[model samples]
Every structure is written in C-alpha cells, then in structure tokens.
Target: MTTPRIVSLVPSLTEAVAHSLPGALVGATDWCTHPASLDVERIGGTKNPKVERIVALAPDLVVANEEENREPDLDALRAAGLDVLVTEVRTLPQAVAELDRVLTACGLTTRPRWLDEAEAAWDAVPAPERRRTAVVPIWRRPWMVLGRDTFAGDLLSRLGYDHVHAGHPERYPRVPLDELRAAAPDVVVLPDEPYRFSAEDGPDAFPGLPCAPVSGRHLTWYGPSLAEAPAVLTTALRAALD
Candidate 1:
C-alpha cells in the first residue's frame, strides 16, 4: 500500500506527523516550525491557508485543528474534493488520542515512540499539593485570555494552576486590564506566543504578582514538545515564584 501524502495546517500536528511518518508530509503551513530541518512545501498561515495551492499539491489528506483553522477554509477544502481530517483537542488525554488517530490516518501502523513518551511524561507528573489561581493572557493589545474549555487551561490545571476565567463562556475573552488586575491571581502565567510576553514586556503589566513567562509551544502545543513540557514549565513557574 502506498503511503498517503499529507498536508498539515496545524503546527503541532505537522510536527507529530513529520516525526511519526517521515517524508509523508508534502506540504505544511508556514507556522509549522518544529523539526527545524523539515523540508516541505510552505502552504500559508493556519487561519489563511491557500486552498487552491493545497489542492494543487494533490495531497492524499490534509490535517487541521478546529481551533487553529477557520470553518470556511475547511469547507472550501472539502468543496474542492480533498479529503480533510479535522481534529479537535481540548485536553491532554484528547491530545494523545487525537495524535494516535492522526498518525493512523497517515498510515502509521505502530505508535511513535514520541507519542508514548509524551503520554508517559504527563502521567508521571505528581498532582500538586495545592492549586494556585492564575490568569493566562494569550494576546496583549486587546488583552485576551484563556477562558473556558481551553487546552492550555487544562494543562495548567494539571500543573496545579486554575485559570481565573475558566467559567467564562468564551474560549478566548478580551478582559480589561483593570479587571484582570482586580482578579488578584496568585500568579500571572504568560506564554510567549499569540503574544511574545518576555521578561521585559509582560511582567510590568502585573504590578505585584509573580509572572511566569513560559514557552508558548510547551504550554499550548500538543506534540513531541509534551514530553519535556512538564519539567520545562515547572522550572519556569517555580523560578518565578521563588
């Protein structure tokens, strides 16, 4: 049986598929930057993928995430008669299961070592003695934060942090900075993507709170990065508090 040619619109999925089924990826979005040595056709950004170009690539399948991609773009891909596999991952367990499903769809019969390692890494994490309240801001200009049912919120919960806005209806809600400051979170968790919240940039926003500036990829992405996220994130969060 011939291996299916794939195009990944999700960055994390691109890395997962690339690591699991080398050379199977024919195209990927510009933001798919893991495995820095990856050589494939650059499609476009996640939200604005070039449908016509993807169809031109004639991939056997195109993988996308419900959160990272827009509905109309997916509909357009389907309209073009292309087989598109859409994945929705909102938690750690879902991420693992989806990775397996995606790898299987890509014709991988055996589970990749990275996937097993990632699962084991998360499983080995001991539950925190006490949970801290946090507010995770994804963007700055309008000040949007992780709200209800977010993958990042789930990861933070596992690491013993509860998002202040977890009960909010919107997945990403724009809250006024004054209101965020008023929440009086024990710590302000900032990931460096969607917005590049560095030491010099993000900490000043929260006057007295400890700011844990972590890798956005580790906090948000669900791929090989998961294997090391616990240790990396723990270290960053602890450093900020200590």
Candidate 2:
C-alpha cells in the first residue's frame, strides 16, 4: 500500500494539521516550524507557494488557505489538473469546519476529540472587559493594523474585543505611531510573522502600553485550533502584565 503523499502551501496548516494527519507531507514552507519532522522543504509561501516544486513532489493532495494563497496560483494548480484543498477560516467555528473538511479530503473518516476541546478553549476566556483592543498586524517603516471589515477584526469582536483600530479600515492599514499611542488599548499584541514582532521588538509604538508578543496563528487562524490561543496568548499576556 502506498502512503499518501502531501504538500502544504501554508505554514499555519502545516504546523497545525498536516504533520498530525499521519500522511507523508513531503514539502512545506520555511515557517512550518512545528513537529520538526517534515522540515525538509522550504517551498514558497501562501501567496507564492512554488507550483513547479509542488508539482515535482507529485503530492496526492495540496493543502492551502483561500486567504493565505493567491487566487492566480490556485487557478494555475487547478488548470494543471491538481485537486487543491483550500480552507477559508474566518471565525472560530469556521476553523472547526475546516478541520472536518480537510480530514474528509485526505480520505480519512476519523477525527480526534481534541478538535472539540480546542474549540471550547476560546470560550473560556472571560469576555473582554470592553471590546477595546488595538491590533497591529505589522510594524515597520509605516505601522499597519487591521480595520473594521477584515476577518481578523471580526474575530476580535466575537471574542468580545472592540478592535479599536478596525475603525481605520483597509485591512492592513498604515498609521502614525502617535495614533497608535492615542488608541490606548487594554492589550496590544504583535504577530510572530509577516512582521516578526517580539516583546523585544516592542510596543515602542505605544509607550506605557500592556504589550506582548504572540503566535500570529495562535490568535488569528480562527480554525480547529483556536482553543489553544487564549491559553498561549494569555500566558504571554501574563508575563507582560506581571
């Protein structure tokens, strides 16, 4: 019997599910840092996963994300006669749906109970005192934050966070440092990738701010693994607040 060969086009899925699926994941991006078992390939990324390289892998399935992978790339893969599975996870519930979707695609009929346990984890966080949080997705020459209409912002709302910066719109909106300081959020977090903000890289953008570093996907993926975020981010938040 031939083992199922797989290729992961997004780091988040690679870390969260691909390795756990008991299939041969021959390739993944540089960012697929978990399991540390299939750390063999550094294929492109969500928007730019190397098609030719993935083709070379001759995977039975390719896992990606609608938001993470570019449409043209997905189009070309389909045109080349590949059955690409794209997951679009917005809120936490969608995340659970995606796990089921991916499991079915892999020709696997079983799912672990941990999936439900994961979903319930986020429910445990005491509702935000007020939905007043400022989310900065990237911070560089020009600081950028998520605005009101984006999926990231919407998740903040569901979790009872106000996402103070969503009023800016434009998904990843660039703002002045002074404006971030003015936002005066109860918590300010930096994602680990796209911008790689650390407690070291800092909340200098918001002085005297309760800032902390967190895994971007842990807080943002909104998938079957959301139950893990609050505990992880809260542990980080505890350190920052303490």
Candidate 3:
C-alpha cells in the first residue's frame, strides 16, 4: 500500500504523525515545530492557513484539531475534494484515542510505541493526597483563563490541580485581573505559550500566590510531550511551593 501524504495543521498532531510515519508528512503549518529536523511545505499558522497552498500539495490526508483550526478553512479544503481528519481531544483519554485514530488514518497498521509510552506515563501518575486549587492564565492584558472542558484543564485535574474556573460557562473566559486575584486560588499556574508567561513576567501579577511557570507544550500539547509532562509539570509546580 502506498503511504498517505499528510498535512497537519496542529503542531501536536504534526509531531505525532511525523514520528509514526517518517516520510508520510508532505505539508505542515508553521507552528508545527516538533521533530526539530522536520522539513515540509510550511503552510500558514494554525488559525490562518493558506488553503490554496494546502490544496495544491494534494496530500492524501490533512489532520486538524477542532480547537486549533477554523471551520471555514476546513470547509474550503473539503470543497476542494480533500480528505480531512478533524480531531477533538479534551482529555488524556481522548488524546490517547485520537492519536491512534490519526496514525491509523495516516496508514499505520499498528499503534506507535510513543503512544503506548505516553499512555503508560499518565497511568503511572499516582493519585494526589490533596488537590490544589489553581487559576491557569493562558494570556494576560485581557486575562483569559482555562475554563470548563479545556484540554489543559483536564490535564491539570489529572495532576491534582483543580481549576477555579472549571465551572465557568466559557471554555476560555476573559476575567478582570481584580476578579482573578479575588478568587484567591492556592496558586497561579502559568504556561508559556499562547502568551509566554515567564518567571519575571507572570509571577509579579499575583503578589501573594505561588506562580508555577511551566512548559506550555507539556501543559497543553497532546503528543509525544505527554510522556514527560507529569514529571516536568510536577517539578515546576512543586518548585513554586518550595
């Protein structure tokens, strides 16, 4: 069987497909930065990919995420008669399952080893003795946080960090800085993407609370990064408390 040529709009999905099938990827978004040596036709960013360029590539399959991609762009691709595989992963289980489905669609006959390792890594995480309440800020200025049903929120919950805005109606809600502080969470969890929250920048905002500056990829991206996220995030979270 001929290997399917793939174009991945999501960075995590790009990494997953790249690892599973080395030569399978023919096009990927500029944001798909994993596998550092990955050389493929660079489409635009996730939110605004050049639809025409993707169609011109004539890939066998195009992988995208519901959250990372725009519906209109996907519609355009489908209109061009391309096979598109859209994945929605809001939890670890969903991620695990979606990875399998994606690789299979890319023409893999068996589950990749990295996927197995990622599942085992999450499974090995022991239940926390006590849960810590946190406010996870994705961006500042307007102050958007991880609210109800977010992948990051679900991942943090597994790590024993209960999101304060988990009950909010919006997935990513804009809250005033005053309200955020008033929530009085045990800690302020900060990931360094979609915003780049650093030790010097993010921690100063919440004067009295511990600020855990963690890797954005580990906190959010659902790919090979999941295997080390538990240990990496735990160390960052614990360092803030210590």
Candidate 4:
C-alpha cells in the first residue's frame, strides 16, 4: 500500500513522523515545532486542533497521542472518514515500542536507523548507583507535579531521581509551594516546557534546594530526541550538584 498522507497532532510524534517519512506529513499542530524548518499546514494546538481544517486537508491519516489529545476530536475525524493512529507511551520502554508500532502502521517495512540508535543509547546507560529524592514541578501558580504513572516520572526514576509525588493520587497533582519546599528534596528538576521553566525563573521558587533546569523534550519527548536524552539529562542533573 502507498504510504498515507499524515497529519500529526502531538509535537513529539510530529517530529517523529516528519523526520522518518519526510513529506509524508502534510499538516501538524502549531505546537509541532521540532525540525524548526518544518513547513506543514498548522491545524492548531494539540488540545484544540481545527478538525474542519484537518478534514479539508484530506489527509489519509492523523497521528495523535492519547494523553495530549481529546477523544471527541479524534471521533470527529473518524466520523469524517479519516484514519487516526493514536499512541500511548507512558514509560521509556513503551516509547520505543510504540514508536516502532507507529512507524510500521504508517507503512515503513523496516525500522529507521534513528530508532535503533535511540534504543542503543538507552541500553548503554547503567542503572543509577544512588537514587536521589526530587520534586519535579511541571507548572507553577497551581504548582502541578509529576505524580503516579507518568512518562516523565518514569524517565526520571530510571535516571536516579525518585519523585516525591510518585504516590500522589493525581497523575499531575497540584501541591502547595511551601509543602514542596518542605519535602526537603535533594534536588528540584525543572523542564523548559509546558511551563517554560528556566534557570532565572524556576530556581527562585526553591531557594535552598539544588535546581536542575533541563530541556523538556529530553525529559518528555520520545522520538529522535530519545537518542540523546540520557547524556543530556545526566549533564543537567550533575550541574545541580555543583
């Protein structure tokens, strides 16, 4: 079968599809910013994609993430006779596996070289010698944290940082700043994403704690970015120690 024209709704998946299949992607959400030179039609945001515009594009398939997109939009696309491939990747291993599934489903008869390289990079990293307690705040104001059963939490756990909110009832729970600081974590890891936390902005929240400002893509994205995440995150985490 001929490879289908694609529209990617998730940012990470957008980069994955664009890099792997090139011009296969005809449309993507405004948030799909990787490959910075990407020139696809902007369908809108992940949470709020322009379904009518997407249908108007007449794409053969739409790629979306279960967590990043709502079902109603996907339902609407399906109702319009468009094929939608939804992925769920909540762990490191799942990310690798799901990407494989997505590519194959997208009509690649063979796995891409970058996928193998990404898998190899994760395999080369040894288990942490010592685990440190950390509180990873994804957003402020309401102060949402990485709580139970999340991809970022799992990624950090594998990298030797135990999230203080791992047992919280909510996947991304909102905790008070004073309570988070009182947790007395060994470090506070800030990712430059969803909230755009930076060295100047994030560290100030936890005055006495060590703060490691890292790239959100390295910590969260599961595409070609995974190939370099281990090294990138370790370097950022190490900087917090000094």
The top-ranked prediction according to lDDT is 1
Considering only N, C-alpha and C atoms within 3 Å, which residue pairs clash in candidate 1? Answer: none
Q: Write model 3 residue lDDT over 5-82, tens digit each, in one string.
A: 999999999999889899999999998889899999999999999999999999999999999999999999999999
Worst 10 residues of 2 by lDDT: 130-139
Clashes of each: 0, 5, 0, 0
Query: What local distance difference test score does each model get?
Result: 0.93, 0.69, 0.92, 0.90
Candidate 4, residue 18: the lDDT equals 80
Ranking by lDDT: 1, 3, 4, 2
Error of 2 at 233 (Å): 1.5
lDDT per residue (tens digit) for residues 1-242 in model 4? 56678899999988888889888889999988998999989999999999999999999888888999999999999999999989998898899889998887777788899999998998888989999999999998899889999999888888889999999989999999999999999999999988999797655799878999999999999999999999999999999987
Q: How many backbone clashes does candidate 1 have?
A: 0
> Where does candidate 4 have its weakest 10-residue lDDT segment?
200-209
TM-score, one value per model:
0.98, 0.85, 0.98, 0.97
Q: State the displacement of the C-alpha of residue 146, model 1, in Å, after optimal TM-score superposition.
A: 0.5
Q: Is candidate 1 or candidate 2 better by lDDT?
A: 1
Question: By the TM-score metric, which is better: model 3 or model 4?
Answer: 3
**Candidate 1, residues 1-242: lDDT per residue as tens digits?**
78789999999999999999989999999999998999999999999999999999999999999999999999999999999999999999999999999999999999999888998999999989899999899999899999999999999999999999999999999999999999999889999997998886555799888889999999999999999999999999898889
Tens digits of per-residue lDDT for model 2 on 170-219? 66778777777787777776777677886666645666887778777776
Error of 1 at 123 (Å): 0.8
